[model samples]
Each structure stands twice: as C-alpha cells, then as structure tokens.
Target: MRLSDISIKNPVFAWMLMFGLMIFGLISFSRMGVSQMPDVDFPTVTVSVSLDGAAPEVMETQVVDPIESSLMTVEGIESIKSSSKTGSASITVEFDLDRNIDLAVQDVQAKISGIQRMLPDDVDPPSISKTNPDDQPILWLALTYDKEDPEFLMRYARDYLKDRFTTVEGVGDIFLGGYTDPVMRVHVRPKDLLRYNISVNDVVDAIRNEHSELPGGYIQTDKKTFNVRTMGEAKTEEEFRNIVISRRAGVTVADPTNMVKIRQVADASMGLDKIERMSRFNGKTALGLGIRKQRGTNAVSVARAVKEQITVIQKTLPPGMNLQVNFDSTKFIEQSVGELNHHLILAVIFTSLVCWMFLGSWSATFNVLLSIPTSLLGAFIGLYFLGYTLNTFTLLGLTLAIGIVVDDAIMVLENIFRYNENGRGRIESAILGAREISFAAMAATAAVIAIFLPVAFMKGIIGKFFMQFGVTISIAVFLSLVESLTITPMRCAGFVHHGERKTKLGKGFEALMENTRIGYDRWLRVSLQHPWKVLIGSLVFVAVSFISIKFLNKEMSPAQDQSIFMARLIMPVGTSLQYTDQQTKKRKRGSCPVRKSNRCMQPWGALVAVFLIPT
Candidate 1:
C-alpha cells in the first residue's frame, strides 16, 4: 500500500507524525545560531614575529625568510605571502580548499618549530592563529574620563571592566585601544654617555639587572630550612635613578674612583609606553573596548547579553568616567535577518492568495497552505543537525522555497478534488487520487533534489558559501513531498468537499484564469502551425539575452544603504602618530557641515576616528 493510503486509513498516525515533526523543528529553530552570513572557516593561517627596533631589512632577512621557507614544507599549501615592516614580520599561508584547517595549523606549527633555533635569538616567539571571521569585534565601547589622568581609565578597564565583560556569555576576548600601561621612562643624554665612556647597552643592562627580583638559594639551619628571595625590584622612580651604571678612576693613578649613576646620565619619570595608535570619539581622546564573540555563537544573542551586562556594570563605574557604545556590528545582522523574515511572511501570504484564486475553494487552498509552514519548519531539523546558522543565504533559500514547496501539495489537491467532483466520497476520492499521483509527485521532487543536491557538494570557496542555500531548498522540497503524501492527503480527505462554496472574488479569479487558458491554447495552435518561424523567433530572443549580459553591471553583492560608511586616510609612511591625529581632526572638522545637515545623519551622529602610525 502507498504511504497516502496508510495515512488515510490511519488518520491518527498521520496527525501525530505531523505534529511530532513540527515540534522537533520548532525546538531546533530556537537553538540554531543567528548571524548575517554563513559561518565559513577559510583554510588560512598567519604567523607573526616581532623584534623591538629591528630594521625592516633585518626583519625580512632574519625573520620573514626563515618562516616562509619552513611553512613551504607544509602540505596542500596554495600560496605563501609575507610582509616585513619595522620591528615586525608577518607570514600568511593559504592552503587548498580540501585541506583541513586544524591539521594544517598543526603542520605549520611543527614546521616553524623545526626552524625556530635557526632564527635570530632576539626575535620574539612566532604567534600562530587561524583566520576566522568571528575574530573581528562585534561591539566597540568608548571610555572617557573627565579628569586629566590618562592612566586611570586604562587601569579601570584592565582591572575591572575587562573582567566584568569577559564574564558575559559568548564573549571571547576584550581588546583595549588607544591605551598604554604606565612605565618608568629613562631619557638618557647622549653627551653624558660619551663623557662617561659608557654605551647605552651598559645603562640598559644595569636597569634590567636591578629592576628584577631574583630567587636566592634556600638557607638551611640546624632545625629548619628557609626559602630566600632577593628584593631588588625598584618601587619608586628615585630607586630607579639610584641605579649605578659604572665606576671610573680619577686622573691620578692612586686617586679614589668616581661612581656614575643613572641619575647623572638620564632623567627618569613615570609616563605612558610608546604611543603607536590612538582612538577618539567626537574628537575627544577615548579608550576603545572592542568585544569579540566566540565561534559558533549567535551574534545577536551575544550582543544582547553584553548590553544587559553593561547596565549592571554602569553602577560600579567611577564618578568621573563614562562608557558609551560607539559601534555595534550586530545591529546590521539583526536588521538584515528581520528584513528577510518580513519578506518570507509576505511570500507565504501572496502564495496562499494565488493558491486560493486557482483552486476556487478556501478549504482546498487551506490544505495547500498548510504544506508551506510544515515544510519550512521541518527544514530547521536538517539545518540544526548540519550546524548551519539562520543566515541570509539559508533564509533566502526558505523564502524562495515558499513557491516551490507548494507544488506537490497543489498537484495532489487538484487531483483529489477532480475525483471528488466525479460523484465520489471525499475520503474515497482522496485515497484514490493521492495513490494515482504519488509516483508523479515523487518524480518531480526527485528532479528538483537531483538539481540542487550537487550544488550542496560543490568544491571550492564559492561552494562553501552557497552550500547552505542549496541544502536548505532541497530539505524544504523533500519535506513538502512527505507532507503531500501524508498530512496533505489526510487533511484533504477530512476537510475538502465536492462543489464547495466559493466567494465572488474567487469566482472572478477563476473566470479570468479560464480566459487566459483559452488565449494560451489559441496561441499554442498558431505556433504549431508555423513551427519554423516560431523556432527562429525563440532563437533570436535567446541571442538577445546573451548579448545583453555585457551591458549589465556585475558585483559579488548589490550595494545596500546600511546607514553607515567608513572613510580611510593614509598618510606618508614616515608620519608620526601625533601628526596622524592632527590630520584626522582636521578632516573631522571639515565634515561638520554634513553632520549638521538633517538629510544625512545617524543615531550615533558623532564621527569616530582611529589613528594609525606606520611601523
């Protein structure tokens, strides 16, 4: 017996199965992550090494060359690119699409380890990390202080704010920008160094030796042993100044010696570390707290949690300090998903109206509409199990499937309705009608699945991006076939009746469709009579379509009005951070007229600037 026959005979079985699927799908939908785009892991890794004050030429030869040579030995490598800059070198290795990124990273690490001993001794250890979209910050906060204490805001963020934000669920890491730790600065006089006949390295060694606490050997007495530690670290600027660099004898052979201390050759004070970059909000110096979310987590959910945590954190902030959100990356994701949802609902509504118009019976139209939600919701089960997010591509697939998913149900419903019109009982017509068309419905669904299934398994980066789209449509189509053979048939048998009443609008729509059918038939007969002319015309139209392609604008994606845009300023390579800040300030002032205009404004109207200094 066919599945439709079983469903018709045992109505309770069909109803329970339908309800069970819907329940499971709803649960899966609730648990699935939401994002702007599908999560794809690129087969790329980066290795960064830094050596303080190393010249670009030195870094390229000593650091970048060795690392690239090592990474070349890793399997499945597509390309290796290196950038050597003052004091730092970065190497990016891209692997083939078939390569597993985790294994590739391990191989790369092993290769680098093999060459580590050959690299320069002073170079820092190589930092290795895989490329991930989630590494980008999802939220940015601007912290400002009313007082002139530059160190206070950074200390508060490091000691308190960072810990608090990290406690929020799904937060991966917190990064601070435009802030530096306080350190003792030693400004050595070049003339004094020459007079003392001491090199800068001598003073550096003296400070490095004196400003560290070292472990001493344990002191053992008769009855007990004690762990001894040397207290050599300086706690105050004066202590650092008192450090002795060298001692020299006087002019006379037997004269007493002269001691040269750090105070004589250098001035020491507490100040910020090197300022390489800065962030500003509304033209005021501010510290930026960028929050990155963990992988495989919902961006919207994480942002919501961070906002809620921010409310709790506000109470603990100091009186003269303030924190405000400067930029939120999740807002675009939320808005895009919301818009897709709106379009999905409209597609369903319009599709239902079209079905009602053609079927001319509200009861039959209702059976067809029931297939849409069941098929779409059931697709969530596949997506959840496949680790797919509710992103643009998946949601777009569902939206497009709104029209396709109704095909199977419409075929079965129309056939069953024809049987009922032939003086047969509803239940008997449904069973006979569905069994007759079940093979044809399955064939049609198979054709669609065959077309899309290959798309899901396509190779390369483009395939990864569109795999969700293909699989989503295929799942929805498959589920629709299942519903048509089971729930759809069952519902039709119970609800649809022969010669059911129709409204005037439905009657008018049916009349219009009948006229259209007659017109189409007349044209079809004419075309059959002049097959040669019709074929030539079709060829001409196809040719025109191909010719028009060159005139069309092409892009990866259409431009959208996201209510935000960014402008970048690149200065000369030798420009300083202070100069970059000044130039950005001038540009910000020049845009005041646009900011004041009511036509072009955003909710966060202030212009946020980031200053960068070349290495």
Candidate 2:
C-alpha cells in the first residue's frame, strides 16, 4: 500500500507524527547556534615568530626564509606568503579547500618543528594557529578613569576585569588595547660610561645579578627542618640606584668610596613600559577591551551574556572609573536575522493567499498552508544534526523554499478537489486522487533535489559557503513531499468538505481565474497554428536574455549600511609613533566637524592608524 493510503486509513498516526516532528524541531532550533554567516573553517594557518631588536632584513633571511622553505613540502598547500617586519616575521599558508584544517595545521607544525634547530637561536618559538574569520572580536568596550595615574586603567584591566570577563560563558579570550605595564627604566649616560671605561653590558649584568631572589639551603635541626630564601630584589628606585656595578682593586669591603654604583652613571625611575600602540575613544585616551567568542558558539548569545555580566560588574566598580561600549558587531547580525524572519512570514502569508484564491475552499487552503510550516520546521532538525547555524545563507534558503515547498501540496489538493467535484465522496476521492498524483509529485520533487543536491557537494571555497544554502532547500522540499503524501492526504480525507459556501470575494476570484484560463486557451490555439513563428520568437527571446547577461552587475554580496565608517592612514616607512599620532589627529580634525560624535582612533608602531566613525 502507498504511504498516503496508510496515512488515510490510520489518521491518528499522521497527526502524532506531525506533532512529534514539530516538537523535535523546536528543541533542535533552541540548541542551534545563531550567527551572521555560516561556520566555515578556512584551510589556512599562520605562523608568527619574534626576535627582539631584529631588523627586517635579518628577520627575512634568518626566520621567514627558513620557515617558508620548510613549509613548502607540506601537502595540499595552495600558496605561501610571508611578511618580515621589525623584530617579527609572519608566514601564512593556504591549503586546498578539500584539506582538513586540523590535519593541515598539524602538518605545518611538524614542518616548522623540523626546521626549528636550523633557525637563529635568538628567534622566539613560532606560534601556530588556524585561520577562522569568526575568531574576531564580537564586542569592544572602552575603559576610562578620572585618576591622574595613566597606568591605573591597564592595571585594573589586567588584574581584575580581564579575569572576570574570561569567566563568562562562551568567552574565548579578552584582549586589552593600548595597555602598557609599569616597569623600572634605567637611562645610562654615554659620557659616564666612557669616563669609567665600562661597557653597557657591565651595567646590565650588574642589575640582572642583584635584582633577584635566590634559594637558600635548608638548616636541619634535630626535630625540624627550616627552609630559607635570600631576598635581594630592589623594591624602590633608590634601591635600584644603589646597586653596585664595579669596584677598584684596592678598595676594602668596609669602605664603599671606590665602588662604581648605578646612581653614578644612570638615572632610574618607575615609568610605563615602551608605548608601541595607543587607543583613544572620542578623542580621550582609553583602554579597549575586545571580547572574542569561542568557536561554533552563537554570537548573539555570547554578546547577551557579556552585556548581562557588564551590568553586574557596574555595581562593583570603583568611583571615578567608567566603562562604555565602543563597538558591537552582533547588532547588525541580530537586525539582519530579524528582517529575514519578517520576510519569511510574509512569503508564507502570500503563498497561502494565492493557494486560497485558486482552490476557492477554506478547507483546501488550510491543508496546503499546513504543509509550509511542517516542512520548514522539520528542516531545522536536519540542519541541527548537520552542524549548521541559522545564518543568512540557511535562512535565505528557507525563505526561497517557501514558494517551492507548497508545490506538492497544491498538486495533491487540486487533484483531490477535482475528484470530489465529479460527485465522489471526500474520503474515496482523497484516497484515489492522492494515489494517482503520488508518482508525479515524487518526480517533481526529485527534479528539484537533483538540481540542489549537487550544489551541496561542490568542491571549492565557494561550495563551502553555499553548501548550507543548498542543503537547507533540499531538506525543506523533501519534508514537504512527505507531508503531501501523509498529513495532507489524511487531512483532506477527514476535514476537507465538498460544495462549501463561498463569499463574494471568492466568487469574484473564481470568475477572474476562468477568464485567465480562456485567454490562455486562445493563445495556445494561435501558437499551435503558427509553430514556425512561435519557435522564432522563443529563440529571439532566449538570445536576448543571454546577450543581456553582460550588462548585469555581479558581486559576492550587496553593499549594506552598517552604520559605521572607517578610514585607514598609512605613513611612510620608519615613521615614529609620535608622528603617526600627530598625523592622525590632524586627519581626524580635518575630516569631520562634529567633535561630539563617538570616534575610535588606534595607532600602532607600524605607522598605521584606523579611524572609526559611527553614525
């Protein structure tokens, strides 16, 4: 027996099955991650190495060259690019799309390890990480303090707020921008060094030797053992200045007159660490807290959790300190998803209205509309199991599927209604009509699946991006086919009535459809009489469409208004940070007259400044 025949015989079974699917789909949807785009792991890895005081030329030859050469032997590498900059080197390797990112990372790491010993000894260990676009920060916050001490914000962020934010669920990492630690700096006078005939290394060795705590041997007694330690680290600027560097040969231990001390040659004081980068919010110096979410997590959920945590943190903050949001990336995602949802609902409503106008029966329209939700909701189950997110691509697929999913239902309903109009009972007509149209419905569904299924398995980066889109539409269509054969037939047999009362609007729609049918028949007869002319016209239309393709605008995605604008400023090579900051300020002043608007200007040591203007 056909599935539809079984569902009609046992109507209870069909209802239970529909309810079960709806329940499971809802549960799966609640657990699925939400983001702006599909989660695609790019087959790329980056290796970064650092060496203190190393020039770009030295880093290129010693670090980047050796690393790139070693990585060349790794399998599936599409391309390799390297950048050598002051004190650092970076290498990026992109693998074939079919390559697994995890396996590729391991292969790259093995190659780097093999060449580690051959590289310069002073080069720091290379850090390796996979490339993922979703790994970027989802939210940014600016911290400001009214206190005069510049180091207070950095210290607070490092010691307290960072740890607190790290504990939040879904938070992967917390990065502090424009952060500098406190350190004791020693400035040596070149004249004093020449007079004493002492090299710069001598003073460095003296401080390294004295500014440390050393382990002392234990003194064991008869019944107890005591551990001891020597505390020799300098606790103040004066103590660091007093550290002895050298002494004359004839100097006595009790007399310090012949001793050469740090105070005599250098000035020591506590100050901020070397400033390589700076961050400002609304033209005020501030520390930025950038929060990154873990892989495969929901961006919206993570942002919500962080905001709730911020609310709690506000109560515990000290006086004269303020925390404000600088930028949020999830706001756009939420709004876009919300808009797509609205579109999806409208599509369903319009599709049902069209079906009602043609069918001219409320019961038939109701049965057809049932299939739309049943198919869409059931698709969520498949998406969840496939590890897909409800992102733009998948949601767009669902929206487009709204039109296609109703095809099977409309075919079955129209056939069953025709049988009933021929004087057969509803139950007998439904069974025979559904059975007759079953093979045709399956064939139509198969045609659509054939077109989209290949897209899901396409080989390339583009395939990866659209895989979810194709699979989502295929799942919705397949589910609709099942519903048409099962629930749709069962409902038509039991609930759908023949010769139901029609309103005036429904009568008018029926008249309009009859006129359209008459017009179509007249055109069909005319075309049959002039087959040669019809063929030529159709050929001309196809040729025109093909020629017009060149005039169409093609792009990966359409431009969107994100409510923010950014400008990048690049200075000449070797420009100092101070000069870059000055230039950025000049550009900021010249570009916009509204000083009260929120602005974020970040300048790094490479003489690059990024200015963000939020609308």
Alpha-carbon error at 60 in model 2, in Å?
Answer: 1.3
* Pairs that collide, model 1: none
Across 214-300, the per-residue lDDT of candidate 2 in tens digits comes to 888899999999999887899889999999885333232355565688988899988888788887776667788999998778889
Q: Relative to the unseen true structure, what is the C-alpha lDDT of residue 155 in candidate 2, on a scale of 0 to 100?
A: 82
TM-score per model over all chains = 0.90, 0.91
Stretches off by above 4 angstroms in model 2 are 194-197, 209-264, 590-596, 599-606
lDDT (CA) per prediction: 0.83, 0.87
Which model scores highest in TM-score? 2
Highest lDDT: which candidate?
A: 2
Clashing pairs in 2: none
For model 1, residues 197-230, the per-residue Cα lDDT tens digits are 7778878878887789988989999999999989
* Residue-level error in angstroms, candidate 1, position 175: 2.3
Supply every candidate's count of residue pairs whose N, Cα or C atoms clash at under 3 angstroms. Answer: 0, 0
